[model samples]
Target chain A: MTSPSNSSREAIAHIAFDDLVALLEAIFVKAGTAPGVAAILARNCASAERDGSKSHGLFRVPGYLSTLASGWVDGKAEPVVEDVAAAFVRVDARNGFAQPALAAGTPLLLEKVKACGIALLAVRQSHHFGALWPDVEPFARQGFVALSFVNSFACVVPIGGSKPVYGTNPIAFAAPRAGGDPIVFDQAASALANGDVRIAAREGRSLPPGSGVDRTGAPTTDPKAILDGGALLPFGGYKGAALAMMVEILAAALTGGQFSFEVDWSAHPGAETPKTGQLLIVIDPDAGAGRSFVDRVETLVGRIADAGQERLPGDRRYALRRRAAEIGIPIAPALLKELSALAGAPTD
Target chain B: MTSPSNSSREAIAHIAFDDLVALLEAIFVKAGTAPGVAAILARNCASAERDGSKSHGLFRVPGYLSTLASGWVDGKAEPVVEDVAAAFVRVDARNGFAQPALAAGTPLLLEKVKACGIALLAVRQSHHFGALWPDVEPFARQGFVALSFVNSFACVVPIGGSKPVYGTNPIAFAAPRAGGDPIVFDQAASALANGDVRIAAREGRSLPPGSGVDRTGAPTTDPKAILDGGALLPFGGYKGAALAMMVEILAAALTGGQFSFEVDWSAHPGAETPKTGQLLIVIDPDAGAGRSFVDRVETLVGRIADAGQERLPGDRRYALRRRAAEIGIPIAPALLKELSALAGAPTD
Candidate 1:
């Protein structure tokens, strides 16, 4: 596919998912990542784009490149996977990206899950800068229930607290159903995701009420204020705060990684990724419900629809994924040009 | 303890923790529970009262008795524990109360956690009508991180839905800390717990906004309207609904138990308990962080405090428990007389 005409440069252009992944891989390699690391991250990033997870898709590329350029992360570090126990696998990411670390540990984690009926994978000293749903959805496709948690840089305040102590920690869950795509949900504990806030600021849009507080600790809807000296609030008040605290314990403490509050990257200017931890819990539902697990999930889906929830979580993503596969992932022409330039390809 | 004078009948009385447990045990036995089951449940109920969890304390006795009397639950049923795998344990509760079933499976579950570093317990055909924190707190006390999910009868409407397809499903988590009690939290997915709604109605108080909808599917704050053919809204909008859906999948579908929507007790009127399922996951943090887990927890706790949050999730409960131990579990004289009558003791 040739570049769109100059007259159509403002129009959206489409690229096959594989083509986009290759382009991203080239970009990561150009940015000094190991080929293996580049492959895993490129696929993850492209999948987010294909599935319309806008914040985690191409919008994150600049941050990734800037962080890499800042010497804050080891793009060439190999992950060390340890078989800690019968059902526990640990990965030392060695200051690398979390996606490659998770990819390196997947085989051992799956083996443990197969044998023990459940298993946990803990990756530490890593940066997870992608959508969490992509990390858990494949397990559900393979007939398992998977949950993943990752804590990022502290930007969220605890309920009734003035300072930010917790990250916009996100929890992702995926479970298999009988007839359709897996049921998947990934949500930030904060009122809104950091990326979404950044997008709002770029678009000159105000945030919803109760989204954050200004530097003075007074509630405000200005995304710029929240992004500058202000802080985001946890969703649902105290309950969401509790969930954020739990995520910190599970993703950071239990994994022996840096807490969100411990992440200090000021020395490396332009370092956007937080060096934290990630935890994944995978359960082989077959061991418990046998063949009936997916059937039961299907039943619940039907009832949720009957109860008037027209779109279950991840339904929109699946639809987008299908449309993208049929045609291609839509991308703005300027972004395509920028990606090509980053990958050292001719923009013509 | 002697009965209070008629003049003090409206005044509060105090009972020792052990004394309250014994009294509740006798009442359970009188209500047709096996002595062993009665002992376990009595202690559980008493602990709630001791901890100041009013809704799950002595206030639940009448509901328990009504359900037992209606023959909706098996007070004498023995739970059969199956060592399903290296890290999986399943319990057939035989339509018994969940506490006893959990008790029967605890030993095996602990063994699995010890051997595999993590383990899961799935209980089916069970009725859980008490506080969920008690189910997980013990594991944390034993130096493990534990999480539990339990689904109840349908009373919560999904987002954008008029009818209730999900229960006031509760998720409880407990984790050990270094300098204080284990961090524990038990929260209902609904905006308010069913017991809280009942309490509000009894006190002639209205619920907070966003609590629920009337029978006509219009939002209302009247507790009575929410209790009469109405339904609760999940806390935090669609996010809470997603969590509720996740709980139903984990607690019921994965356990081969009845979903909240499947719980039907019309045949046995006055059946206040929902025969659903429960799921527990226990992780031996030592397998990952070794001895540093608690220290990490302590650090997080300190930061939370420093951030201006005065109290953590379980702080109030622990304070109340300590006070109760210093004095006694407080109860109204009228309620004490009612308990005496239920226990078949002479009331003077």
Candidate 2:
């Protein structure tokens, strides 16, 4: 048997993308999520795993199960889509996951974009615990330029502020190109993502300088300190802080969702998700001034390569995705066993 | 005479905002711009001066005149607006100033936004040499949220690249508030604005570390070197670079204008402006999910204050504008004389 282990020390298990999605779907359904929600989330999480977004992939399964078990998120809640205007679509997630809300509203959002050349999707009362690129990449694949913003629970401090008032808010953008995969990026305004800090704490690793401050408001590199009532700093200081604030406005305030600071989950123990809001803007490049949008994107990509920038934003993900297609997605044996147990499958 | 001299030594002359606009208008007309173009440019420049954006105010007059003299820009070119879709408007600036193009398209853009809940304006073949806040702030005052992006001449490098592939692309956002001035922020993707680097070079001052790299691609603090042949780093490493790239795509590729790296003014020695593109998106907050958009903004503002943030993004500009309104715009006697000479007025 040709084992797919790339590392020398540990033997790894390899599973096809579809199989992984099926397993995750079973796990979610077992955890009481609606079948539709499970399918959407399973695909999203499996795509992340295939693309090497480890932080948002299988690592998030335990959190999702815990939050679902805690009754903090209504996995069976059906999203209510509202056709607000010619270019606006609002979705009430009804405390469900943001992905399902987005999925439910996407058809209407696309119709609006088709009619108006651009459209806005505002999703409120949602829990967004996945990588944001998944929320936008499909639009790019459909030949639309998409930008999305999502605000999470408060874990980041404003500039010159001692208290946490902003989440590790993320901004994601996706645009199509002529010859290759879409250019996509999902970045958090914080110096380090909350998930990354948690991973570091779990691994007994230290964070980079300027990542966060301790509870006493003193800068520290210890990940545990940052997780223990401490707050993350915005990347690039004030500019990043401004982007974070903008995310709050666009996601929470505009969507009629709770602000990052307003997210109070004390009533539900084991809740790991932040019930917040998300905003997505989709634009049709055919309505733009450019003669050929994808051709122009190709030109830019060539220029960037000529400039000696070896990697574009989504290049790594595309590479990993291709590798995953060629050989099944690599997973550790322990993780695979855990996932099998969650799915009620026999583990070898 | 009760001169508005905030400084001890210099005898600063005080002029009302209207007077300053008139002076700038005269100067633009003397420099060969159409009366309409001059009017719009004058108000934009005057507003910058009133709001303490000195780099984009009178300090930009020489560059404008120089570019005009080089015959690199058409000062009198009329903007042509096209209503492309229900929510998309395009403007061909015909190599003229971007302000006039935006002015010409604003009516249709507003109409579309009102009807469609959101609208996009694309301006191509334009020169945007002024501050970006002016482009978005007015929309906020009109009960809309606005976001704008403009890419300039290439002066920033992509990460891991030695060549300059991106400009000091700036993104500006404006939103209405319930009880105060609009919340606005205009920030460049680079570590510092090109104007600030020029100012530092003029003052023989060193820049902060990580600002830019010298000619050989080594990090340096000398603004002169950065101006000479070096390139600026993005604000927050790869994140800022990604934004800069996105701006190029949105403002140039999407708008059918020249990319920053494609800007070639070598034949026009005195040319200073980048004949690029701009993109603006305006949304009607009343069409959003929120009950009251402005009230939501007020809530965020109050929370920010409570979070110990002593100042917001646009607070300083509002304070400066108020002071200017009360005491008139203060200008150095020498600079005032220069402006008067350019306007063909008698200098005392």
Candidate 3:
């Protein structure tokens, strides 16, 4: 595949989607992940790349490999699922990667949701490191309404407080449509994602207003100050902060996982991946609303689209996904070279 | 009962909590409401006043009475609760006020949630005209985590569009604690609630930045422009807009109710309340985490509290409620006179 020029001055390359998947799979296997676990990890990476999430794509391989090499994440561990109640499922991730654990639990959740109108998955001992949409979208595709929450390492300060007590803590929701891709949305509670803040600082750029506060508890738009010791402000003042708190409780406390503040970042400062937790809820609209569900969703979505300038959620991601499949995934040249070395292949 | 001086320089009067309830009940009864329905409505109004929610308290009685008088609401209609699925309860609100509808459905929802760990109530043909916290907080007080969403008449523009496509679309979440009032939050998706905008316009006060846009779709902070011919913007930009869309789907599409845009506001313009729908979900943490649920919530809340200068969600409201109980409710002199006339009492 030929590289398409973007505006950035960085050297670029393009790899066919299949080739990229194989490369990531080989690298994860080389880093000592079990073949099945490596396959799931590679698929998640490929999807991120396919959806234009470069920060979580090939770029995260190095961090994942580091955690694998240090034996912080058990590459061979199998997640255990338990039906704790009539409608509640508990998944013990066995300190393994989140993607595979969720993969194991989702089918069970779908079955329960069919029997009951709603079902919940409480996943603990999981290491999550990618977009949450991938974890929720499949259920929507199968005609279920899905919502998910995940808590990570603490990186955000509560509104009106000086210290960090909550994570960026993302939430994702998806609903099925009649003849189109599901309506999906994923957002971190913070005004800016940590990855975006890091990229801005690396490029010496200022952030948007209301992004973060400095160590002295004063609001600042300087990306560097925010990254050094400051804290990212939650989006929409106290409202977004409350949503963050909701995520912490649902993903951690309710799931029997460690609270964000209880995580020992000091012990693994530059080392292991964080052990986190996630909660996924799935409901079958057909159970109650019947066949009218998809038409109703389409009605609401059509109204948004007919309004001219308004775009439906996930419209951009689905468009990018199609382009990625057609023209391949764009990658920075330096990262491609690193991937080739990890894959034991010659750089083009 | 006496008036208290506020910086707004408006005339104020205080009324005993019991008196306010009795007066509201009498007014609703005189406006052709069923005696039982009027009692529930009065209780809701009293609770709102006691909690310092002036916008939803006695202030809303006039709108409710107008709807009742115009026969837009069925004062004698009884809500029918159906267990449509294993864990879903569908409430036919019968085009009546939402308070009695929720009152009829809540017991069934509570029973199902205890048995199945989680349950949902989908209310259709409802007229929801007040704060959402009261609807959800009752479940939280009984050791359940509850969430609710309701769609009203469209008054908010989606992000990136000028015309209104969504309602204020309030969402409320509440989680129980061991020894205190539950942690609760209720917020409208709009940057400024319609009621707040009206108050600001009435007082000729400027709004906070990024609150709304003028008729031509230009951003403005003038409360008059926002209320007169413009639309309120969603809070937190596109992220908040997505949440508003979620509410529309859940409340209208899933519940078989009218979407905000589909409602013919012109049909009843000044006389009737909008026909809306609401979705309520309640989860019993004890079903999954057992006795540790309250402890976990307290731990997280305590950590936030330990970080000095931070306030927990609902703290202010709880404090105001305590004060309201101690010193009675403060009302404007004009509102008092109107209430006296409605209640057939002699005016001072």
Candidate 4:
């Protein structure tokens, strides 16, 4: 009946946490990223799962590896400064990935301020940085405030109109919290975070609906149709449309890179990856007044987190990391087997 | 009927925008804003009309005056250097109006960035700064890229969840465009911009149905019901929700200010004035290795703008501004009469 229905056979694979991390770290390092960058990037990818961003998690192993394998995403490319001025900094990714580009850029930013106490950096020609949290988290951990954004494929349309011309462009910000993990935030400006929808459709699952529009601009739950000709609807319509536009201009426009339609990472899937860039900003609290600024800012965050059930954006992920460390990650058994075979190891 | 419909009987009052600016400049000077700040702020508020944001234009005068009158938003207060340390600047607005705070903070950020060449300035305890574009355009005009965001009263809920927990926060970014005005972007995170909705409702027009949901979550085109108990729907929905959350956390969370339900603009008709804050990031082009960067950026923008009747983002406003100069400022007879009273002048 119905060719043994794709629904009943659908099952999620739960691979062990350590197994996934090891595989990621090994592949990333083998691909050419410096051990330090590799470790941090892997850690960040693992961290994505903790935040329930599984689509951006280690499941991206094949995709990322392919980028390195094809030499489109230079695993060992070191970022270099492309432009610098009184109030701006642009970094050339040199075709390297985003993590190292950001890492290289952050320190340069710190250096500029040592002169005048402020700097702005636009990082271009870089690949995705997995989750933006890690990009900002370090600064927060160091008691600094940071903001960042990156452009992906353009699948969203302008407000009050149709015609897909903007990317899901994600934006992020982080702030230091005393005696706690820095508050980290990362978000995409798509109704269903395209990634989740992609993953769901790949798994033969039906979306909760209202996430996208099918061809002809009607509300839809059928993910495949939505993905085909029906473009993604903006988050709050015009507001969402405006934001998607803002991100496109900010992340790409400011960087003097691909802005509107050129950002098609082939939907961040395999083959012919797109060229994208990033913008990272760092704020040194001491520059505003000095002395107890960090502590004071931390106090503010603490008060908010303590005020009620309130917690910072990355709190849930931090909690999940703790749980993963305690109870082991819960990847599907089938996924574990495949990863194991890919690693030339067998699942226990 | 209905006390003689004010709108239909209203006449159009024509006045040179310069005259209106002069009047506003005088009022602000009298209110104690620095001459420069007052002039600039007035210019910006007036420019909002030129940009088609009438709600933030002269319409906001009474509320701004009320804030000045109440002392919640100080006219005489200046920004205080609350903190600073390499690539970061934090300003305590000291309860000052937002324009001056932004004015004071923008240059400080530009000056501080030395090596990394990126700086973030977190500003707190500030009032509205008319249009976010004006606030950021200066940096781009100076060949520096800038991105800014402002959080207002909470106006939206997270995706898949009910109840308003975040505001329809607005975000903006300005990028240099060689010889052209910087490519400016500004937007909120709701189905329809709140101001647009308000203007539509005020004009006795109906929303294009599906713009918002009624109190019971049923879709309706009535802006009144949507504003009252019905909620604003997100663009592309969940994406919109995530975006609102992103803006709130960045604009409010990182600044040691209010966030989510904590935002309350007293003038917004339903809640207290939010403990608002703004995030200003400026990136100087020369902070890196390129010189023709501005021209390069323009090439890309030009290519897109030339693509079949696609005027750049802020072009219409500028065009309108130029045309309106000759046509004269067209204010409703009702509003003109009300504002004419500001100078103790005759209503006719």
DockQ of 2: 0.85
lDDT for position A198 in model 1: 84
Cα deviation in Å at residue B112, candidate 4? 4.4
In model 3, which regions exceed 4 Å deviation?
A1-12, A345-348, B1-14, B332-334, B345-348
| Candidate 2 vs 4: which has more DockQ | 2
- Say which docking band candidate 1 falls in: medium
List the RMSD of every prediction in angstroms: 1.6, 1.8, 2.9, 6.6
Question: Model 2, B33-85: lDDT tens per residue?
Answer: 99999999999999999999999999899999999999999999999999999
RMSD of 1: 1.6
Worst 10 residues of 4 chain A by lDDT: A1-10
Total backbone collisions for each predicted model = 0, 0, 0, 70
Candidate-wise lDDT, in order: 0.93, 0.93, 0.84, 0.65
The predicted structure with the larger lDDT, 2 or 3, is 2
- In the range A71-187, model 3's lDDT, one tens digit per residue, is 677888899988877778888889898888888887778777888888888888888987888888889998899999999877788877777788889999999998699999999
If both were scored by lDDT, which would come out higher, candidate 2 or candidate 4? Answer: 2
iRMSD computed for candidate 3: 1.8
In the range A75-114, model 1's lDDT, one tens digit per residue, is: 9999999989999999999999999999999999999999
Supply candidate 4's per-residue lDDT for A287: 52
lDDT of candidate 4 vs native?
0.65
Query: Candidate 4 at residue A133, lDDT?
Result: 73
